[model samples]
Target: MNGDTAALPPHRPGSTPAGTTDTSHIVQGTPAFRRTAAALFLAGFSTFGLLYTVQPLLPEFSRHFGVSAANSALALSLSTGLLAVSMLIAGLLSDRIGRRRVMVAALLASSVLSLATAMVDDWSTLLVLRTLLGIALSGVPAVGMTYLAEEMDSRALGLAMGLYIGGNAIGGMSGRLIAGIVADHWGWRWGIGVVSLIAVASTLLLWVQLPPSRHFQSRRSGLRELPARWRSLFADPGLPLLFATAFVLMGVFVTLYNYLGYHLMAPPYGLSQTVVGLIFSVYLVGTFSSAWMGQQANRYGRSRVLGICYGLIALGIALLALPWLGCMAAGIALVTFGFFGGHSVASSWVGSRAGAMRADASALYLFAYYLGSSVAGVLGGVFYTHWDWLGVCGFVGVLTVAGAAVAWRLGRRTQPATGELALSR
Candidate 1:
């Protein structure tokens, strides 16, 4: 058996070859493939939906809790910060246990926590629940990517990852829209409660539909091996750049949305919470862009498509700087498009490049990804507090430009000659 065969699960009666290089992988147009896709889609949906539900309510939290805008953002920042730290451990845990088991437990626990968050009256208690929610959510994203990398056909990986991320887009939009609209009629707590209930439904669907992993090979090494695994990933020229791209892309995207509601609610715009939430409906554009651009990456090149996405993001930021609301709306749509597309390309690239280290590489990538969300997101609030919207814009602009530079550098790197470890260059 070759390296590819060795990486796959032990063959049983009637099993196909393992790994994306052969027909054994879950390919498109098959029932198994469809089930896996649907399962992962729900995973992305529930995880992101639960993570971002508190975002649109930041302003509402400020009013109810009698805190500042920056302080209110802790509800999100705390979750993401803890999430970033927890994913490193979660990845290793899944290696010891099983991917599906970890993800299922995570979804159930997080949904329960979100429901509890809806009932909390104290600000500190709410923050505590959100923090634990982050730890619960850590099981999904990294492990899901590793699952796709292990089980899906390599040729179809981009599209599969895109669909999963498309689910994330819809979840994010729906969560914000639901929370904002319901909060208008009832209260922020009601908005959260409704979202929590929806998450429970999604969790049940995922539990029933997702097939057991057929290609997974459990690792015996524990945290003692983590440092070496991470070092190998960073030593790769392209992987580190891809990780950096994840950081900036997520940070800039979160920062823009974090304060957008506050900006529209104040002064000349003075839009209601419902109207501000409606603005997030723009995330629908992300659903399309992620799949479309993922296909584009498969056809053209991952790096090339990623650079275009960064350019679009920078241009959107420029449009947002204008005082006109129409321009700002268009800018939001463009930013949404760019962000989802860039994320799809970057994440798929990491999977394709990581080879045997898929789990560790994905975990580290997301660690940076959410770390950016935690750090830059809160920092953007500081900019808003000081120089208002322009300050926020400037801060995000710098991050975008820096991310674009990294994408450019990665595009110039040469693909490795080894077939099993080759990247789309």
Candidate 2:
């Protein structure tokens, strides 16, 4: 019934190979499901919490490292780009190994790297360690989705995924906020260490709480299958559009935050790091919005909800032009809400659409998503230079419109996604 496709496969999550007791789980909306989802939410919180903690520290980085916008961006961009690449491997390994183990180890290892990055004395050393951390962080983002598809009931998958993405919203916002606040008071290093400890705690919780995968199969993976899987995914007509949407949406979102901090910190606004950090508390709304949107998508369908979300995004961008500080903050909140909602819906839909290749499909979507972060995160620096905040808004606004248009097309496109329309060459 999803996407109005009658030919849609049974929405049920397939179990692991027959009689695989270690992975057998029932998603009967029980207390167990809530606990599992909570464990996964913490996993997401840890994953993104570790991944984006450095964002608020950018100004301090500039002072300590004496780098320009683009160069300083290397700290974050390198992490996301490396994380993006690592997803491909994580996908392959999860298919061959198991989702729970891969995710657990990924969380643990990344926490170590994050702690290491915090201790580094020089920017060069920090970037090097952060890139490594980014690579290590890739494990969770890569396998989390396939785990949901394999374990959670299809009926509950949308809401489960929303909570997970909601966790991401909270982590991302709080990570940046904490880094900014802690760095303002203690130091950036302490901020990073604090979040790393949080991640360690979350990893342990995930290890004890997450049920083993019941629906996944350890398919023999060779280097050969990777390219073939990529080929198969790209062959889908719907996938290319999905990938493009991922790229544009993520690109615009990262770009906005990357420069917006600098804008608020500079003359005219002259906000302190702590105040700027409070801006990140706006992420709470995103957390709420993502979960709400997911429930709405389940109730009304993704297409309509996606359109509304994107429209809100465009409106949010326009709000940035306002002169008042309150309006600017509200603008940011709207954008945050819109992006998370759109992301949750799009990411969940990929699992449903791919049918069999959920890991690879998730990998591809994440690949686009993080690459957009790296590319646009740096590119927005140019806009930040010329027209200041307004210029940057103009730059991201175009991308938002393009993304919205694509979302509109995706909602209305009824060209049967089965048979010949399965994939595009």
Candidate 3:
């Protein structure tokens, strides 16, 4: 057996070994922890890079395919909608097979599909490929979260989750920037091709670098038991709220970015595709905020940090409503910072609260997350079409306010005995 898996004695599924609790986890500062973080970071990068490569190209698609903004957005919405549904199946599959295997397969397969997407010319065919890409990519996020919660030391789990999400931030920005810039010089096809190629490289590196699962125990429970497990997760005091937060946070964030290019590319600004894509550089703030707010959550409390994130998001929206271009830029940066930080806090909270049902819980949280992305992203386009930028801002503001209320309610709840940080007073 490998040294990683050799340290722990065997135990029944869903139960910890009597005395190996601390030793079973990958502690911070150890080689295994570093390997796991590196692999997951690459996984996050590849997964999101492939998933969102088309975002910056939506206007291009609209012009080429002779579709409206909302129709062009189907390129992203279809993928996210299917991804939301597919993650549940991926979660169950991971429990039966293994988290590492599922994530590796997903990254490789999604990369290949992205390469295929770059070759397609027809509009419907492109949507079909994007939808399939969503399904293919579903294996990474939920399973990755489950793997972290199961294997990482409780004290270090927040930071691990944050790092993984930080990778997501960078991947998303790089994908958009590369695609936008390359599309200006060559075409959208070449842009997607380049991003797909990068995804393949990241996937290959992750395969070699990721250590095998050390703490995962295979569950024999099949789909028949899924309902009961999900019921239990929903019955928990905090899990449902965390899931709602995921939905609102992702929805608001995606809606803002989905329409931003359209807004800036229009009459007054007349920004080029490359310049609009460069604006996504604001996502760099997300890379910082995800890791930083997660550590803050570990110290100050998840709910308090989460609430502050929502406040920042609201402030950003207010700034975005201003007609000034610099205010809009600053607004985008603040929103990016808040959304990533909140997601980190909420996701880590789900893991801590779910206990034995972490896999299902993670899947549910992401399902809501992407579902929001699909639904609200499309709706924002409708608002933009009718009323322009203010309409979109108003729409996102409503969602942000609702999310803040959920965070406040969560703050008032008593922490469970599961070693989660207490809610800040």
Candidate 4:
């Protein structure tokens, strides 16, 4: 059972009144806002920490399981792929069952699955567990932003979203670092096991820290009505571009990292597995940029900041093509900064534009986001095999250019959308 204390009245399915948004919104720095932020921070941490713990272990998997580089990437790409698809259903379930229940269950269940994954010996069984873990992970990301948008004060939403994304950056970095270091010493199984244990602690923290949803009102859009919400989300003039942006950004980001480990491990640099993992600690840059640039977007304009971030991403990709390892590390740092910053702006922008359709819009963005990870991640290996790092950079550079184009066009026409709270207030 969800440990909620009934902070808000329970609205029955199909019983949301037209003016349901008239409820209170949690402003930043208040106790409720603090609790909400802390809860979501832990949620973001655990979800991504568990999801990406295996990334640094891909090389080990290839050695032990006797798989190709591309096949090894499937361990991660498959989870993200299934997560992309399952997010839609999970969002709908949250709309019916309540955000707390879906997210809490997602955290606990996925944590357990991650632990179980460490015990599996067979590659096929490992793949199966990862796949299920993806499905189990769906409920949180699908619903967390929606919950924030629905409950947080409109003026403070951007910063709250930024902090959430910041948690993701740290969690992702810690998982990769810890796993890589531990795997180098103890083996991949123990690496994964350690991450799973951290996830368990994070889950418990989330259960206790996240206060019940104070502004949530149930909207039971049954399975039959799901298409209409999808239609509504796609019909928004700007949302489609934002979805494409998610696709481009995530594709370029994942593709760069997917092969970089191999490149570093094999190159003139000849870094150890532990040092290679330490490079991922550059994600600390992302942790800063996501929060800082989010507030910048809020203060200036999301589109304006987003367009600049796209340019930064391209610039970063270009730098990676250089011969020196120092250049490559710097490039990765820039790319991490840009990717997380742009993600923060775009994600919060989607939530702001979604109105009552926040969950559906978020799901669509994530669907495209992880879909890019799955598709481009594997495809990048082909580029690496044929043309080397230059080929990978060129491919991602093209995607980054496309993203910049979308952002430029989007910034030209769309204004910041004031949320439902503004109308109700």
**Best by the lDDT measure:** 3
Cα lDDT of model 2 by residue, 206-246, tens digit = 88878655456678787677888789887876676788888
- Candidate 3 local distance difference test against the native: 0.90
> Local error of candidate 4 at 190, Å?
0.7
* Rank list by lDDT: 3, 1, 4, 2
Model 3 quality (TM-score): 0.96
Estimate TM-scores for all models: 0.94, 0.91, 0.96, 0.94
Candidate 4: pairs in clash = none
User: Please, what are the lDDT tens digits per residue for candidate 3 over residues 180-231?
Assistant: 9999899999999999999999998888888877777777778889898898
Candidate 1 residue 25 C-alpha distance from true site, Å: 1.1
Write down the TM-score for model 2: 0.91
lDDT of each: 0.89, 0.81, 0.90, 0.86
The predicted structure with the larger TM-score, 1 or 2, is 1
Model 2 lDDT, full chain set: 0.81
The local distance difference test score of model 1 is 0.89
Model 4 lDDT tens row, 192-257:
999999999988888888877765666677778878768877777789999999999999999998
lDDT comparison, 2 vs 4, better candidate: 4
Least well predicted 10-residue stretch by lDDT in candidate 3:
1-10
